[model samples]
Target: MELQQMRYVVAVAETANFTRAAERCHVVQSALSHQIARLERELGARLFDRTSRRVHLTPAGEAFLPAARQALEAAERARAEVAAAAGEIRGRLAIGAIPTVSSVDLPRLLVNYRTRYPRVHISLRSAISEEMIEQVKEGTLDVAVLGLPPAGRVVGLRGHELARGGLVAIVAPGHRLADAGEVALAELADEEFVDFPTGTGARVQSDDAFEAAGVRREVAFEVNAIEFMTRFVRHGLGVGMVPTAFADELAGVRVLRITDATARVEVLVWSRSRPSPPAAALLELFDIDPESYS
Candidate 1:
């Protein structure tokens, strides 16, 4: 049967009244009845039992209604998919981002994207790099904004480098490090350090930073949330290392520059191979000047 027939059938099934369903479907009552009758005839079945005062589904109609509803939904979804592919870019885009990007970049990017494409529905997920990659591969995430290099080996995806920013040390205001303009990596050898748990994107960056400085870290506490780690640093729990942007925003902690060696963390935008047009459209908004990162 035609998609319109399916729509008419579903409307009638929901309202269980001819005039009400007709009004809801924005069709004249007589036209709605004719379409339903045409659908029933095409299917070679009596779909409804109607009297002057009441209308109800017959056994065949009861069986047909759900299938009809499903068909209509599928048709609508197919239409939307085609529309999006045609550069309409007016559908749901699922975005997964690591904690650091979620703090600032994502909000700004989403705001800009919404202003440009108001009809598009955007869903945001906060995840670490590895998890975000997994979601993209499994088709759960349309795109991901994560720290570079990817946590896992690159497989079945493409990555776009967005920006790069330096790491900063977060220390308690009263701590010795608070007085320093910049501290050497060797100075952290004896200090208690707060950092992300192993296997996290931040942890990978933290490890690389120390390795680049030819120093081994002395991590006293390993936690997931940067905010929590900063808190730990603020109360003299340990010195914390995080993105300069992250450290700069914390009120109770002072950020100290790391000296001797320059370190950088790259922000990356990634998506699975052959992403949907909606995903591609949303990804465009994430583009920023690489120079802006530092």
Candidate 2:
């Protein structure tokens, strides 16, 4: 029932180990377990099912977790809002981005944000566009930078375009199309490709382009990282399709323009609800009106 008890429960649920949760909460194991037991007794339900090897949330714990998180978030926001009104911005800012983000220099931007709001705590994570979008919607992420094919849309969320460009092809020096200035999708239909996993936003651009042009290509190498994809192309494992800026950075691969390539759109997205003070400040740095989204 108490906030401290809820904190212990949430931490235990996240770590799935009483000892680890106690360490994370800066308390002893016995104390955290005792508090959680008190909470469970007060609620007339057991929140967790503990075994000798592992711990997991019981049905009651699953129902209690979301409300506990909301309560904690609300308390933190209240404190942050009061601080902001007193001319000091203090809060947590959780940002998510695709690994291949290039429209903005994230490191530089975050440094500037830190300089401007020294009291705010910031966390950044890299994930595929779809996962980031879902995190933003779930309120786990305050903002995100994501890329999608031109035909893709950001449904159920608020976002604005940052940049749009077509993907370029890369081939090894010894490949048959290495000397080509430009090639169409059909020309590369028979060539094996090194690309991101099938449903990722990075792979969708090339996939849509091939489908639109009625070309079917084999993805011989599937990788999650752009650097790995480029490396595969450099070793003649397969051809790759990557952003122009990324392609220009590689040394051993020959970059080729795709005549029928689809464009990738980079977008900055956030929840449709009003943003936290820290998130609003970050959005303002981008010259975006946060109130518009609200």
Against the true structure, whose lDDT is highest?
Answer: 2
**TM-score per candidate:** 0.66, 0.96
TM-score computed on alpha carbons, candidate 2: 0.96
Tens-digit lDDT track of model 2 for 112-226: 9999999999999999999999999999899999999987888989998999988899999999999998998889988999999989999888888898999899999889988
Give candidate 2's total backbone clashes: 0
TM-score of 1: 0.66
Minimal lDDT window, size 10, model 2: 242-251
Point out the worst 10-residue segment of candidate 1 by lDDT: 285-294
- Summarize candidate 1's per-residue lDDT along 191-260 as a digit string, tens digits: 8889887878777877776787788877889887888887798899998887776764788988888765
lDDT of 2 at 111: 97
Off by over 4 Å in 2: none
Q: List ranges where model 1 is wrong by over 4 Å.
A: 1-77, 85-87, 102-104, 149-153, 260-262, 287-294
**For model 1, how big is the CA root-mean-square deviation?**
10.4
Clash count of each predicted structure: 0, 0
